[model samples]
Target: MKYLADVTTIEYNADKCTGCGRCIEVCPHGVFDMNGKKAFITDKDLCMECGACANNCEFEAISVDYGVGCAAAVINSMISGGEPACGCSGDDGGSSSGACC
Candidate 1:
Protein backbone atom coordinates (compact mmCIF):
# COMPACT_ATOMS: atom_id res chain seq x y z
CA MET A 1 0.00 0.00 0.00
CA LYS A 2 3.06 2.23 -0.26
CA TYR A 3 3.10 5.26 -2.50
CA LEU A 4 5.79 7.67 -3.61
CA ALA A 5 7.27 9.33 -0.51
CA ASP A 6 6.74 12.78 -1.95
CA VAL A 7 3.09 12.11 -2.66
CA THR A 8 2.13 10.80 0.74
CA THR A 9 1.63 13.46 3.36
CA ILE A 10 1.77 11.86 6.78
CA GLU A 11 3.01 14.17 9.47
CA TYR A 12 3.35 12.83 12.99
CA ASN A 13 4.40 14.91 15.97
CA ALA A 14 5.37 12.63 18.82
CA ASP A 15 5.59 15.52 21.27
CA LYS A 16 1.88 16.06 20.80
CA CYS A 17 0.89 12.42 21.13
CA THR A 18 -0.93 11.34 24.27
CA GLY A 19 -0.63 7.58 23.76
CA CYS A 20 -4.38 7.25 23.73
CA GLY A 21 -3.95 4.59 21.04
CA ARG A 22 -6.60 6.22 18.87
CA CYS A 23 -4.37 6.24 15.81
CA ILE A 24 -3.40 2.62 16.32
CA GLU A 25 -7.01 1.65 16.70
CA VAL A 26 -8.33 3.54 13.66
CA CYS A 27 -5.57 2.96 11.16
CA PRO A 28 -6.52 0.36 8.59
CA HIS A 29 -2.77 -0.22 8.05
CA GLY A 30 -1.06 -0.73 11.42
CA VAL A 31 1.01 2.41 10.86
CA PHE A 32 1.31 3.39 14.52
CA ASP A 33 3.01 1.59 17.39
CA MET A 34 3.23 2.03 21.14
CA ASN A 35 6.57 2.91 22.67
CA GLY A 36 6.22 3.25 26.42
CA LYS A 37 3.25 5.62 26.56
CA LYS A 38 3.74 7.48 23.31
CA ALA A 39 2.54 6.56 19.85
CA PHE A 40 5.00 6.40 17.00
CA ILE A 41 5.01 5.66 13.35
CA THR A 42 5.86 2.04 12.67
CA ASP A 43 6.27 2.39 8.91
CA LYS A 44 5.45 5.44 6.88
CA ASP A 45 5.40 3.30 3.77
CA LEU A 46 2.50 1.22 5.00
CA CYS A 47 0.19 4.16 4.95
CA MET A 48 -2.49 4.12 2.26
CA GLU A 49 -3.01 7.88 2.57
CA CYS A 50 -6.26 7.27 4.37
CA GLY A 51 -6.88 10.00 6.93
CA ALA A 52 -8.31 7.88 9.68
CA CYS A 53 -5.39 8.29 12.04
CA ALA A 54 -5.16 12.03 11.50
CA ASN A 55 -8.89 12.46 11.82
CA ASN A 56 -8.99 10.39 14.97
CA CYS A 57 -6.03 11.83 16.81
CA GLU A 58 -7.32 14.12 19.55
CA PHE A 59 -3.85 15.30 20.48
CA GLU A 60 -3.07 16.61 16.97
CA ALA A 61 -0.16 14.21 16.72
CA ILE A 62 -0.98 13.14 13.20
CA SER A 63 -1.90 15.03 10.06
CA VAL A 64 -2.08 13.87 6.45
CA ASP A 65 -3.47 14.70 3.03
CA TYR A 66 -5.62 11.87 1.76
CA GLY A 67 -5.32 9.57 -1.27
CA VAL A 68 -3.43 6.44 -2.59
CA GLY A 69 -5.87 3.62 -2.10
CA CYS A 70 -8.08 1.92 -4.66
CA ALA A 71 -9.90 5.20 -4.26
CA ALA A 72 -6.98 7.17 -5.70
CA ALA A 73 -6.04 4.89 -8.58
CA VAL A 74 -7.50 7.23 -11.12
CA ILE A 75 -5.79 10.28 -9.67
CA ASN A 76 -2.44 8.67 -8.99
CA SER A 77 -2.40 7.15 -12.45
CA MET A 78 -2.86 10.52 -14.01
CA ILE A 79 -0.09 11.96 -11.92
CA SER A 80 2.29 9.19 -12.99
CA GLY A 81 1.22 9.61 -16.63
CA GLY A 82 0.32 5.96 -17.00
CA GLU A 83 -2.66 3.75 -17.49
CA PRO A 84 -4.62 3.21 -14.32
CA ALA A 85 -2.78 0.26 -12.87
CA CYS A 86 -2.94 0.77 -9.15
CA GLY A 87 -4.21 -2.81 -8.92
CA CYS A 88 -7.52 -1.36 -7.90
CA SER A 89 -9.44 -1.29 -11.16
CA GLY A 90 -10.65 -4.88 -11.27
CA ASP A 91 -10.98 -5.76 -7.64
CA ASP A 92 -12.57 -4.07 -4.73
CA GLY A 93 -9.95 -4.13 -1.99
CA GLY A 94 -12.93 -5.33 0.08
CA SER A 95 -15.97 -3.08 0.11
CA SER A 96 -19.11 -4.52 -1.45
CA SER A 97 -19.14 -1.63 -3.93
CA GLY A 98 -15.54 -2.38 -4.97
CA ALA A 99 -14.43 0.86 -3.39
CA CYS A 100 -11.70 -0.63 -1.25
CA CYS A 101 -9.89 -2.18 -4.20
Candidate 2:
Protein backbone atom coordinates (compact mmCIF):
# COMPACT_ATOMS: atom_id res chain seq x y z
CA MET A 1 0.00 0.00 0.00
CA LYS A 2 1.14 3.48 -0.71
CA TYR A 3 1.12 5.39 2.52
CA LEU A 4 0.51 9.09 2.62
CA ALA A 5 3.42 11.39 3.28
CA ASP A 6 1.50 12.66 6.26
CA VAL A 7 2.53 9.58 8.19
CA THR A 8 5.59 10.35 10.25
CA THR A 9 8.74 8.53 9.27
CA ILE A 10 11.23 7.55 11.93
CA GLU A 11 14.49 9.45 11.95
CA TYR A 12 17.39 8.39 14.09
CA ASN A 13 20.11 10.69 15.41
CA ALA A 14 23.09 8.50 16.15
CA ASP A 15 24.71 10.98 18.52
CA LYS A 16 21.68 11.29 20.78
CA CYS A 17 20.88 7.62 21.18
CA THR A 18 22.16 5.95 24.37
CA GLY A 19 21.36 2.32 23.42
CA CYS A 20 18.67 2.33 26.06
CA GLY A 21 16.53 -0.16 24.06
CA ARG A 22 13.36 1.58 25.17
CA CYS A 23 12.26 2.28 21.61
CA ILE A 24 12.66 -1.34 20.62
CA GLU A 25 10.57 -2.45 23.53
CA VAL A 26 7.64 -0.22 22.64
CA CYS A 27 7.52 -0.48 18.86
CA PRO A 28 4.86 -2.79 17.42
CA HIS A 29 6.57 -3.02 13.95
CA GLY A 30 10.16 -4.12 14.66
CA VAL A 31 11.32 -1.03 12.79
CA PHE A 32 14.53 -0.82 14.81
CA ASP A 33 17.44 -3.08 15.61
CA MET A 34 20.24 -2.75 18.13
CA ASN A 35 23.64 -2.09 16.62
CA GLY A 36 26.08 -2.64 19.45
CA LYS A 37 24.44 -0.29 21.98
CA LYS A 38 22.52 2.14 19.77
CA ALA A 39 19.42 1.56 17.68
CA PHE A 40 19.17 1.61 13.90
CA ILE A 41 16.36 1.58 11.42
CA THR A 42 16.66 -1.87 9.94
CA ASP A 43 13.30 -2.02 8.20
CA LYS A 44 11.88 1.36 7.42
CA ASP A 45 9.33 0.05 4.96
CA LEU A 46 7.78 -2.33 7.44
CA CYS A 47 7.12 0.46 9.88
CA MET A 48 3.47 0.94 10.87
CA GLU A 49 4.09 4.66 11.35
CA CYS A 50 3.35 4.45 15.04
CA GLY A 51 5.10 6.92 17.33
CA ALA A 52 5.72 4.53 20.20
CA CYS A 53 9.46 4.58 19.68
CA ALA A 54 9.66 8.34 19.60
CA ASN A 55 7.38 8.65 22.60
CA ASN A 56 9.46 6.25 24.71
CA CYS A 57 12.81 7.69 23.77
CA GLU A 58 14.19 9.63 26.72
CA PHE A 59 17.16 11.10 24.92
CA GLU A 60 15.14 12.50 22.02
CA ALA A 61 17.19 10.36 19.70
CA ILE A 62 14.28 9.00 17.69
CA SER A 63 11.75 11.16 15.87
CA VAL A 64 8.69 10.11 13.90
CA ASP A 65 5.65 11.72 12.31
CA TYR A 66 2.84 9.60 13.76
CA GLY A 67 -0.83 9.53 12.86
CA VAL A 68 -3.59 7.12 11.99
CA GLY A 69 -2.43 5.02 9.07
CA CYS A 70 -5.81 3.35 8.78
CA ALA A 71 -7.91 4.12 5.77
CA ALA A 72 -11.01 3.13 7.69
CA ALA A 73 -10.33 5.77 10.30
CA VAL A 74 -9.95 8.50 7.74
CA ILE A 75 -13.04 7.49 5.79
CA ASN A 76 -15.08 7.18 8.94
CA SER A 77 -14.02 10.60 10.12
CA MET A 78 -14.92 12.12 6.81
CA ILE A 79 -18.26 10.40 6.68
CA SER A 80 -19.10 11.69 10.11
CA GLY A 81 -18.09 15.19 9.11
CA GLY A 82 -15.58 15.40 11.92
CA GLU A 83 -11.84 15.73 11.81
CA PRO A 84 -9.87 12.65 12.64
CA ALA A 85 -7.13 12.15 15.18
CA CYS A 86 -4.71 10.63 12.72
CA GLY A 87 -1.73 12.67 13.92
CA CYS A 88 -1.17 13.83 10.34
CA SER A 89 -2.10 17.36 11.27
CA GLY A 90 1.39 17.86 12.75
CA ASP A 91 -0.09 17.63 16.20
CA ASP A 92 1.11 15.06 18.73
CA GLY A 93 -2.34 14.37 20.22
CA GLY A 94 -1.07 15.68 23.55
CA SER A 95 -3.38 18.61 23.88
CA SER A 96 -6.00 18.82 26.64
CA SER A 97 -8.72 19.93 24.21
CA GLY A 98 -7.82 17.07 21.82
CA ALA A 99 -7.77 19.46 18.88
CA CYS A 100 -5.36 17.41 16.78
CA CYS A 101 -8.16 16.38 14.48
Show how many residue pairs clash in every candidate, following the order shown. Answer: 3, 3
Q: What TM-score does prediction 2 earn?
A: 0.66
Cα RMSD of all models vs. native, in order, equals: 6.7, 7.5
**lDDT tens per residue, model 1, 7-85:** 5689999899888999989998898999999998888888887799988888888899775455465665666554444
Candidate 1's error at 46, in angstroms? Answer: 0.2
Residue pairs in clash, model 1: 92-101, 93-100, 93-101
Residue 9, candidate 2: how far off, in angstroms? 1.6
Candidate 1 Cα outliers beyond 4 Å, as residue runs: 1-7, 68-101
**TM-score winner:** 2
The lDDT of model 1 is 0.75
Instruction: Report every candidate's CA lDDT.
Output: 0.75, 0.71
**Which 10-residue window of candidate 1 scores lowest in summed lDDT?**
92-101
